[model samples]
Target: MAEINVTPFVDVMLVLLIIFMVTAPLLASGVPVDLPDSRANPIDQQPDQVTISIDPTGTIFIGNERVETGGLPDALAAIDRGQAGNEPVIVLRGDRTLQYARVMAVMGELNRAGFSSISLVTNSSQSAP
Candidate 1:
């Protein structure tokens, strides 16, 4: 009787699992934003939610595509139309180093675009105390 070698297969599987675990978070958001720390609980992310990322330099991105400040409403409108009847939720990820006014400007644009369900993304607070 011949026995299958399970040890080598298990080693390969463990290595692949470790690689995925390390890369999963990095792949989560294409646009990297240094989010501010918050004590608030994290919200469940819906698959169809629209993400708007603002980098440290104040450049805005809708998904992975860059959009001008003036063009934000139009971009969001396009996304809204593609969602059929389901209401679109906008997730804003602004860098921590950005000024409050810059962040507010983006929010104001979303508000003007008639997107009510907006959530700000922040990193969970890590305190030693």
Candidate 2:
């Protein structure tokens, strides 16, 4: 009767840890995108970077925010100006089901916004040696 039972405490802690482990990865993935596989080596992720995602429908999203098609240029320009002098890398992710033209158009807009440090995100099919 004097002994303390710690079984309940350990069970609760284990459950919480498992929940966090399952959800942590989902947070970094952001929007759902079926990225195309590439054999090229993966690049190092930048500390200061912007994520632009284009879904299978060709809809564009800046980070998690959705922007109008006509407003993409201005949106990108605003981000560019907001950064002052620091040139942040732009990571573009387009669904593999999308047309090449759509991706090119987004790239063109990025270029127009004076962002030269742009990178394309792709799922690597093979590990780089």
Candidate 3:
């Protein structure tokens, strides 16, 4: 009877697990935005959701895809059609450096498009609440 050693395999697996753990949080940093910090608790997010990002320059994006100039309503309509029966939360991520009116305009567009489930994404406050 021959028995193979499993120690090396376990060590390799452990190293891989540690590597993944370190990088897992970094993976969600999509479409860089300097989000404003808030003291409020974070919302319970679902897996199925649509992300609307507004950068510092006021450029709009739907899940990393850019929306054409002055075509937000049309883009939102397309999203609604594509999702069909699935009603996903529309998460709005506006850069901290962005103008207040710019964020409001995007929210208005979402409202006009009939997306009721909306969330405003913000970074956690550094200081204690």
> lDDT of all the models against the reference?
0.88, 0.89, 0.87
**What are the TM-scores, per candidate, against the unseen true structure?**
0.90, 0.82, 0.85
Task: Give the top-scoring candidate (TM-score).
Answer: 1
For residues 52-129, write the lDDT of model 1, one tens digit per residue. Answer: 999999999999899986787788778754555667789999999999999998899889878888999988987732
Candidate 1 similarity to native, TM-score: 0.90
Instruction: Name model 1 segments beyond 4 Å from true.
Output: 81-85, 127-129
| Ranking 1 against 2 by lDDT, winner | 2
Residue lDDT tens for model 2, 1-129: 599999999999999999999999789767899999888777988777899999999999999988897999889977844456778999999999999999999999999889988899988887554
Candidate with the larger TM-score of 2 and 3:
3
Best model number under lDDT: 2
Q: Lowest summed lDDT over 10 consecutive residues: which window, candidate 3? A: 78-87
In angstroms, give how far residue 18 of model 2 lies from its true place. Answer: 2.4
lDDT of 3 by residue, 1-129 (tens): 999999999999999999999988667656788999898788987788888999888899998788989989889988743466668889899999998988998998899888888999998986975
Query: Which sections of candidate 3 miss by over 4 Å?
Result: 81-86, 126-129
Q: Model 3 residue 12 lDDT?
A: 100
Candidates, ranked, lDDT: 2, 1, 3
Flag clash pairs in model 1. none
Candidate 3 local accuracy as lDDT?
Answer: 0.87
